[model samples]
Target chain A: MTTHLKRWWPLALLLALAAAPYSALPLPGLLDGPLGSPGSLQLIALCLLYGGLATGYDLLLGRTGLLSFGHALYFATGLYATDLAMLEFGLGFVPAALLGTACSVLLALVLGAVSLRVTGIGFSMVTLAFAQAGAILVQRNPGGYTGGEEGRSAPAEHLPDALIGIQNTANLYWIALAYLVLVLAVVHWTVSSPTGRVWAGIRENERRVEVLGLRPYGFKLVAFTVSGALAGAGGVVYLLLTGGATPQAAGSDATLALLVMVVLGGSGTRWGPLLGGVLYTWAAHRLGDLANSGSVAELPSVLRVPLSQPLFLLGTLFVAVVHLLPGGLAALPARLRPGRAARAAAPVTAVPEGAA
Target chain B: MNTVVLLTCTGLGLGALYFLIASGLSLIFGLMDVLNFAHGALLSIGAYAAWWAATDGGLGFWPAVPFGVLVGTAASVLLELALIRPLYARPRDQILATVGVGLALPALITGVWGSDARPFPQPAALSGTVDLLGAAVPVNRFVLIAAALAVLLLLRLFLARTRYGLIVRAGVEDRAMVTALGIDVRRAFTLVFAIGGAAASLGGALAGLYFGSVNPSQGTGLLVFAFVVVVMGGMGSVTGAAVASVGVGLVQQFANYYTAAGLGDLSVVVLLAVLLLVKPRGLTGRLA
Candidate 1:
């Protein structure tokens, strides 16, 4: 009965979240307005969007243990391609999104083929270099397409009428919710499938998989391509939410931010990245708001300065998490339950020994 | 002809700065198996400290460089002891922690000093131009090249002659053997971090003169090129870093001048990609 309840809880939660728009519930301290208000919905939508993104990124980092630092390249590709398709080619929203996602997938396949040739830190560096190239291209704003550093906004005429204007924020929020659900479904299905077992094998010990007559490279590449594709789709949602593409979206820092999110959430776990992504996005936005609030301003300069910058606090928190919480927030519940913690710890310690 | 001469001079000067950052990066990665992402933050700290010393501390340009180097070295040492040393068991986490430091330090810098570029105080000696091969080259360029040369010579001497350097060299080649030989490899790790930080900080101080201004993001901006140099030169090889630094800097300068403005940076990245794909072991055949 308990196991059955645990399995069905997510569905129950999804239903409640879906009905959130109709409820005028005011979440004090967590949000400035009522739950159904545009302002609150917008923030929640951004959180959901990142939660989906972090989930996608976890496919590589958590499931496959491939630390590609260039995840932002694919995301930016989706964002820029979609925006440019609408602006330059006059394509409608759906077609533009499809084209952007295609671009991201194609780029991922090619780059992944090249990068997977090397393993470990070499792969990380190579991916970083490639992403830096992409960033430089966007920043260069060749032919004024990328708008250089300032970036370009989405062409409103090409977007569907429903996706535009402030009143349609709920629609955007729903779209974000749909994206998170789609990603969760895809990731959940893939992680449980045969390919996912192969990924776990590769993550634990690539040579063992090879000895078992399998090539790890192809499996790794599939993970990369799928993750990249998901990131691309997320980018389209992000463009809708923010109303534009910025060069920052294409940068190494963006990828680092994703890394922070995934790790903070707990990389390999099912709900970890999603919870992390939502909490992190919420904190980032709320911290920015709090920095501008009068109470923060009234504090001493030393206190005020660090509080003013969200990234500083976030980065420091990440460091603390790495030091104090190795398994991330996902492991916290397990830690609180001592009997379950010991049982969980047993297998985790045994796996390394078996692999070695 | 004059344009070529000027570009070459400036490129070599740029190469000098890259070498300073790359050399330390190579050593740290080689000895510790750590890609210290915070290396860039060290450079930024150095630049800020030097800028602070020269302007606010009233130390002037000549004395400010050492002050910056001292502060940067201290910070690097503290980082190694506090953050990195504890994470010795987890190699991946070490890199992540450095990434954290890399992120936080810049944000802190920006918080303290506004994000705007502060005009670097230039010494009169470095402000003037020198006639070099019919090109009016900035004296600062010559200063940078000279500083790089001195560092190269000193580094080579230390590595070739000193006992600690010998241990470092051995540690890079076979860490297990060095540890088995009853040598405390951890001490050498701290020393390497100190050396890398000092060199990077020194680069930061000189970089201010090179750019004529200091900004929080300068270290991170140069860090990409330094990574390229580290890859090209092969990890842990000082002489290799020197050669690759010159090659990368010249190529970037010439490419930027000959082709489009930003294409040079793109080309350099392309060069790194091609090089890695072609020869995974890098120039010196060092896999690390």
Candidate 2:
């Protein structure tokens, strides 16, 4: 919590990580290898993205007390924007990301202005309507760029010379880690700021926050915009890293996946998404190995099922955790760290404060 | 005039179906305030139940309808006992519980029945087509529509004319106050669950007939559409859900007919969004 510790902690982590390469290389073990490669990176990115989303969602659901299910609209918009930028304009990943996310901020403003008028389930439904609308628009008219149902693939435009020289997986894993770290830093800054405090106030009770002379809706819009921007950024990373996106990236399934990740790992917790994503990804990938063969393709056709059914597991996890572990993964360290156990034991109100 | 009549008739016909399905959704939500995401799944259950019973289950369509209804209604009862009972108070928890139950049945069905979409044929009695307004509508659909109307009438009577209905209305308005008034809240929930189950089953059966196929994935699509209906109509208002259900069905059907195929779904989504965002309630002010 101190300035000195905060400054040195990241450095220590960096140094420790640097030393990892020098140390006797640890085997991939249970989660290490050919299987874990793309899967692990995607899960890690997913965690960071959800961390951003859950925080944004919390701004409404947890903070402002509004639950908007349609946040995916902004996400999909950013994705489309990125899609065009990278695939059509041939922009590098970073610039394409900036443009897409910037566009999302604007789109969020328009969406938030209208939808944020009502809170709770209404907000959630309205947002969903927007997401559905966006999906339909893409489907109906590819506009020669949206790629319709087939979806637009991400052009591999930004791989640095350094990455090209090294193994591709290592480069991607590092990119995932770096982006995640960057997102954490931004979230920490926001959470600890005065604006976030108003959000905290907004979450407890709108009338109370309004009584304090701050407009809850306005702050909520700001929070929503920030959240949308981050989600957009996540979509960009997804497109750029995975190659491209379709309406699938922005559908209820994908958004629900993010929600599941947040709830399972711990919504409002900085690292909870990471933890939750790990659980979900592992469950999803390994569930196919029900017979212990490690490959879904290897399994008998009779036993084979679409990966979507595992969504049930993730969904179950969301229900269990919300009612059971409302605090999410961030609550873990608080429970373990010597003096923080007591703090973690307090009511759910302060859970967000210790999240990051 | 024909287009208008056609659309309105179509709306009413579709509305009848939505009413069948949504009534259960509304009743369940009304009684317990739990937004059952799996209401559609229950419909799927009913559809498959009817399908398997009548066809593979060795019964015919007429018999299958009741069988499916039983399957759906029973599943609803079991779901209430298993999950809904415990999470009655909290909205999020209730959402989660209902969703989990919804997810489970569909997954199990998918596991049992492969991923390929299968067709469930309407029995010969209802399979014939009828000509009206120059349109040859299916006999099964007309029967389904008539059956749906009967259901609406029954639901109306049940809700407006019965002691259970009065108690349910009271339960929706203030669950605690109803308990304070000496009604067994738990019993009310049980009744609601049964009513909801029947509605879901009937709706699912109807959906099965109309679509001629019922897949496990049907629940999620129907679930989202129902949520759109609920919010569009107004949360906890049976009338609102009924109307909104009709509205959604008409829009979806007509849009598909009129607009570019893929674009139509988008338009429906966009229309609902604009309407909701502009009027956070709905066409009928259902935000609450």
Candidate 3:
């Protein structure tokens, strides 16, 4: 029983974290400040939403080795679909979410078919261009459905009473937690399956996979579709939490933020992105607050300028992480212990070769 | 016919600006196999530096141009040595690092210069419109064209006449061979990057004068256009960049003239899509 528990420790730890907000047990001071505040639950919910989104993103970037720059389109598709359904079509939460996810899946299908033709850097650029076009199209708001640049919102009447009332923190937290867990299960199943093996194979060597008589394109399409649908679902959760959606939600910045989250968390690992989402969101919030305040000005003048700019820190962190910790936060535990070199040399490494 | 001539000249002038910006991008990529996403940041830095020199240094517009180019070249050299050197072999990290620099540079610019756009006054000599074959065109447009021609001529002469230029050209075709021949490929790459930086800054200064303003966000749009031109022209070919810039300029100008109000930009997106699908190697690039 002890050996079995040791093997499943990570999952067990995650479960404990999922229950932390509702546990009602007083966490120590540092944890209490971040998790016990009235608004802190919202941050957790955000982490879960982004974590699910990043996990979905990894299905392409990590699992299939495709680097798409316009993935926020799928997330936006889901949100806008939900927003339109709830506000314009007068649908309930479940129906609206279904509509959003279905729309995301359909859009993914079309995008995957066209974009999977090109691979590597060309593919990334094409995705970016398409995403920009998609954003423009949304801003145009055909038939006045998208609300243009103003964006669209879910009507208060369509939301569940609990979700509508911001005071229902526990309810919102549970729903977000459920969404994240569901995503983790789905991603875990997908990556562990035969489909996932083909994806990793494609990432390693596309030509060899082709020689093996497997049409990599079809498998890639599946991964793309799955990722889009997953990100779409995340978008729906965002709508429920925020009550609105903007075209900027699918812009380049959104894609970049998602990419940063995935990379920070360790791209290929199921749990890595979830942790990345939590850590990134928390860090951004904390660092941004610190930079905006007078406290940072007290530091050395030269350090003050860079420290105050959160983006500079984030960018520097990105470079440092890619260089120093190629396997991301997921590999840190293994790095800390003895015999680290052998573990680092393992072939199942998530870091892209020669990327450091 | 007058309107057509005016539009044609406008297209050429815009294309020249693109050519200046993209030539450096192309040259650097061809030689280093590194895509400097921060290229646009250098352009913006030049624009702002020229604006600063004109307004703050009291150097007036004409004298500030050289200062702007110098500042841009210095920044590019700093970027290459401090940030880019370590990530040479790592393509993905290079992209991310450059993107980080790209994001951070604008923030710094905004913090220093404030977010508002500042006017970049044109010199009295090039401020007015002139009649060109029955069309009233801005003298600035003519100057831009002339500047582009001058730079292109210099580049041609440098590549053809100088031993250093020969080394650069050889380095572009095959890095290993040049290295084997005992050439300092690193120094050649640094020179190319500096030249590219100067060219972009020159483009930025001209563009600032052309538009009558420089802003923190100035580089974003131009950077996108430069990237498209670099890719569309093929990665490393200066000639390809020049030709593609003109093509993009023509397409953009015509689209703005003919397409629906919001759809002008969509035309470029569509063009990029079709180009990628039909000929992924771009117009002149060998397949990667």
Candidate 4:
């Protein structure tokens, strides 16, 4: 039946993506090399890593309706902790990753408790302040631990031999793919359980849930903790993909980029954030390539300048999506179908209003 | 003792800049419930415009300030009308739109101007140092303080004496009630945005003088501090912003001087967190 096919399609897609490393198909415009090439695998792995991150972030934004502006803090915590553990404490890869994830979870619990005290925009600002503090700490590189402006790279000796060189990029790609699958499975399981139903209630109308003798705070905290944990794990993978922990991962801009990804994908919908993440990462990389390709150099300065910057184009595209496509790219298919337009056009996520 | 005086003066100067940015941010958030994330971008526009005017447009520093303010105000008004007005129904979208603008404008600035910091043209009169409490303080600090004081006074007078100011205050208190009273609150929103843009742009111009150079990321870097001031001062209270700005600035200056260079910034953020956790309603206890 079509229903069974629809339900099982994700598994099929997963299988196909898992086998992508062995493919030598040359996609001319989409990538610079064949599918199995180290360069292509690296880009794909990065995209997959972000896809996982965006999905984790949606645990707060889409499911629980918490607009956290400090998600990057946890991500950065995972990144820096893993790198530092390896570099300073002489921990191997697995142990360092576990420690990093633990740190992120602990930070989320502590900060989430403080931030959740104030509802709505206050919570957002509080999280932002905390993240800003973290960013400042990293940038100051107290006692030269964080490498000041330039981030510290992972110690190659500490990492596994398979994850060290360019030839092993496919292994990294597999790790990224595994991360995405894990997140997808966890998010799918959680969002369907009883706790997930409560999250839905919290997202829709917290007052109603409270009136029914339930505590919204506890539910929200769980969501925040789990989301933070997933982000931390993603950070570990990101370190493997990129080979370092950069301060950019801790900045507010990084959080904003995640927000953009979730919104662009269609918040609250399965697979939307993943698709958006992959698409955005690909576009940004391709655009950067195009900018440096000297093609735009021939144009007038006015056109050439805007074309050269990937962020400008992405930001503008994000705004347009926010305006015209309220439900994001996920809603596009439904919108195109006859008589389903109105239903699909409605915003997928119920954003809390006037709380600032 | 002289070190303390110099630090206090410099901190106050920094606080003045914070006030300029925070006051507008407060009013806009108070009135529209929109976070206006692009506020930093507005400051950058003003700074870049003034920088261009001083160097490429052949305008002196005195004339360039007003020119920058003008351009900033125009850009903000356009943003309000074109981008923000359409999404009045969707508050979150409004914030997202501003975020987009925030990202895009800075990237545009870097693309056109390059990422390097450009030296601000110092007016001969403002470049010299003046002895303050036996500490040689830069004259530009005094200029910034004077400008902030003037703006503070003008803003208070406008809020207390003008009819538009009355509408703004009322709208902040209860927007639906103001609409029920047969008033067009949207006009006040545009006006507030304009006012905020002008103040932020002015801050940007003075910030250039204070820092001795202007860069694309300067406005955004200061924006975090401005957010601290805004939250500490209460969301919509102009007077509260002025007081908090001075407090934060002084704390940052003294802490940075006595301790680590970045510790002051960290302390200010800590202060904001503590204040929010303690009071939640801010110092003024006035809700937007």
Candidate 5:
């Protein structure tokens, strides 16, 4: 989700990604869409959006102490902004996307300024209230701008003139996959930087960071803005995926699901949230399909599960992760990495300096 | 205005439920400083248990409430031993672990119960209506309100008048100091955790009756509202939570009423905006 993403990455990831399309691929048409069909491409676009939202969540909750339960507000704001622009004005996707991202980032700034000040549970409460309010506003307003409960769709959907030339599904999928790779690389780099280290410092001890005369607020604002913009862009992609936005886009259960996804995947790790989201989204779809098709009497009756109740599952998963895998599934990869333990242990050596 | 009154009544009942669920959470947070996210899931467990007891076992709703509380208490005791105990030393682990358990365990429940919402019908004796201010207020609503108030008052007496309550209060202030005072602080912690689970179940039992249905997702819905109450009321203060729950309940009710669109959720958004701008610590709660 980094805008000015660097081109170069480690050789391993580059080689792996380069081989993605060609190497031992799943044969086309195994299910429905071809390898690069519009459906598949749209799925990739949504995955990327999930990745970006997950990253935004991690930046605040995982890295910092702020855990806002209402981030769907920003995502919804961006989506609604895009929808409204297209409906009201004859705006193209490009300008509409940019405008959407801009408005959402501004919204995040306003929210963060307030929500971030209240750490921990208070932060969660404030954000929930904010997002719920947004959803409620859209619901009651009948024929006014938001189209009431129904919501407005993007008619005359503009696939950029540039995309029109290519028009193949594979190209769009590749583009989305590339965006995910690029965003993670940028976030990885950010975490490895001195500023990232400072953020970690602030997370551990705030009074100490202030005592050291390093202004954590500036970095926090920067982080908030960057995370907000990336999330907004992700919202645009989500808008593209669904072809519209509604107050449903701003539900607490959905947002909580996403945040729990972050925790499941490993909060601070680069790849954790993506892993979590992919698993969660897949399970959700499958479960939803099963539950809708039959009554409790059908099948094992166990399979007839509704979508909303899955939240209990999500909550339980979160609790168990904290209980057992303290570091998350993300920690497993690092444990296997060469000299990671030594590198992690190196922190023990630095503790004296940290104290000094 | 009528809407406000209606919402206030409803919100207070819900807030009372919040008090039950969050009381345990606030107590644990005060003493251990571990944010118990799984508390919501615990409430759901009680709800399901009561629902099962009432439905499959053919027990009455009145009997099911205590049954649910007991079932919730057992779950909490096990949760503390298995999930929450290990994370006691590492606060971050505790937070993440509880959150993780919160997710995975709920999944297991949904997996088992088929993830559908099933109703826990109120006893017919409590189901009749009474006239209140030219409005049709169900006898059940009054029961719910009275139940919440009764719990709150009982909790107050427990904390203020009882010996264990004073120890728990002292423990919240400073666990190490409490240990120095030679009261078994860890035992006290476990007791508080059990109490929290009990309170959560009691709330869930009430919720099932009030809604005339218990969905697995009900706990998740109440989680945020409970959090809002706990945060606004501040940690370690049950009275603050009680008051805040009523306040938020009233606010949410009014939002449901006059604001239109069946409760101006946007009003909540605006309220949060103002709250963050003004008192980030919450109206009555202290900053963490």
Candidate 6:
């Protein structure tokens, strides 16, 4: 009973924390300040959306040990499908989102079945190629549903009133928050289940798992489908927030951004991706804004130019995280606490010696 | 008949460029388990270097080619030594690190060179058209084809006859055995990476001449193409990379000729996906 309570308490606390801003209850000064701003609320919502995407990505990457370079194909599909359903078919958000996610799952199953034939880096390359192909097709807009390069916005009349109306900032935030919780709950349930153990085994050694009579390929495909569905769901939230979808959202850049979130937050941990997504999105947003018009502009042309490109800093951050902090930001608390760093280092130091 | 011949020639020229980039990619992966995502950046750097040498340094194309190769080689060696060496045992981290480098380098290129693409200036002598099978082709196109063939022959001869080539091949087959045999296999990998960088840069310089212009974003697209070629050829097979590159180049060229604006690129990617689905080991790769 105690163990079960301990396990459930953190989740309950997290849900309350997420809901706190929407509630009328007064909070601490620091929390109250940021929660009150419409812009801050919107930013937080965006971070949650990204966090949700990263959580899904970790299912394939961290659990199944698949590095899919084209996962954005699913994201694009979700957004595009949802947009088309709402605009062209006159469907509501819930039905449109469900339909879009279904399409993304179908696409993932097809892509996964074909790609999983090649292991490791080959899988990454195949997925990348497919994604690139998908991006181009969307850019071409043969059916005119995608709106080509300009990217069509949901007409004000077409959207569900709250999503894009004047009250949108708060409405979008709550909606994104709700989706985030749902996605996280699903991921947590899936990872803790018996199936997730098989995925973990496959990640460690496919041949060994195969020898044990488990089908690694089918398991990987299921993980891919689930991850794709989650990413597609994130896309639906993104549509709700921005009211539009661009081909760029499904490009390799977005894939890299999502990868950074997953890796930075702690790839295998349940809460790590969510933490990473929020931190990364917030940092990127703040940094981009800060660099554009602030003290950065005063620097010399040579100095400012490289700093001006937001991705340079992002890339540098990713490298630093990989090299210095193998476990990512989520591991920092354990490392930073007194006496814990030594304890962590002690076991790690013995590992290489044993291998050698 | 003219269209056919012209398209064929166009395809070969593009194929030659693809081979230059893909062969190095194949070789580097063969020797060192490193994917070198930054290789595309090396190509772009080479193109920009040659462009700089020709326009700013007032050097001729021939001199600029070597300069670009040198710069590219140095950069690649630096990357291998400083960044890649420590992460050799961890492929996933290596991929991530290299990807970070890949992203950073292009942004750096944009910062240094500005965001705009410029037309690559060709030498006055080679810019003119030459007659080929009742078709008018640029002299530079023939020049590119010859250079590609010459490089392929040299590579073949090196692999077939040289002691170092034998060592590289032996290492690829079994690194542990080669290490036990007292060869410093890591040093050989560094050499292979340098050579790969040189090849990519040379190709980049020539690609600029072929395509007539380049920009920072060019590396990203080229990286994808190189990956397709490497995969289609089977990883770690130089000869297979060469053959697959030609096929890819021709398909891309023909697709561009027949299709609307962006579909050519789309078709190339689709072709790679379909081919990969059909032949996972690539056309000539060994299944270990």
Considering every candidate listed, which one attains the maximal DockQ? Answer: 4
Candidate 2 lDDT score at position B99: 57
lDDT of 4 by residue, B122-183 (tens): 99999999997799999998999999999999888888889999998888788899999999
Backbone clash pairs for candidate 3 read none
User: What's the lDDT for residue B182 in model 4?
Assistant: 100
True-vs-predicted CA distance for residue A28, candidate 5, Å: 11
> lDDT tens digits, residues A192-267, model 5?
8888887778666767889999987776766666676667776776765665776677666567677777776777
CAPRI tier of model 4: medium
TM-scores for all predictions: 0.97, 0.86, 0.91, 0.98, 0.83, 0.92
Query: Compared with the true structure, what per-residue lDDT tens digits does model 6 show for residues A151-224?
Result: 87865676667677645578788788888888888888888898988888887778888899988889889899
Q: What interface RMSD does every candidate have? A: 3.0, 4.9, 2.6, 1.6, 6.0, 4.1
Screening candidate 6 with a backbone cut-off below 3 angstroms (N, C-alpha, C), the clashing residue pairs are none
Q: Alpha-carbon error at B248 in model 1, in Å? A: 0.9
DockQ of each: 0.59, 0.47, 0.49, 0.72, 0.47, 0.49
Please give the range of 10 consecutive residues that has the lowest summed lDDT in model 2 chain A.
A347-356
The deviation in Å at residue A72 for candidate 2 is 2.4
- Per-residue accuracy of model 2 over A43-134 as CA lDDT, tens digit each: 44443444445544444444445556666777788888977887778887678778999998898888888888766656666777787777
lDDT of 1 by residue, B149-202 (tens): 988988888888899989998998889999999999999999999999999999
Docking class for model 3 is acceptable
lDDT of 6: 0.80
lDDT value, candidate 5, whole model: 0.68
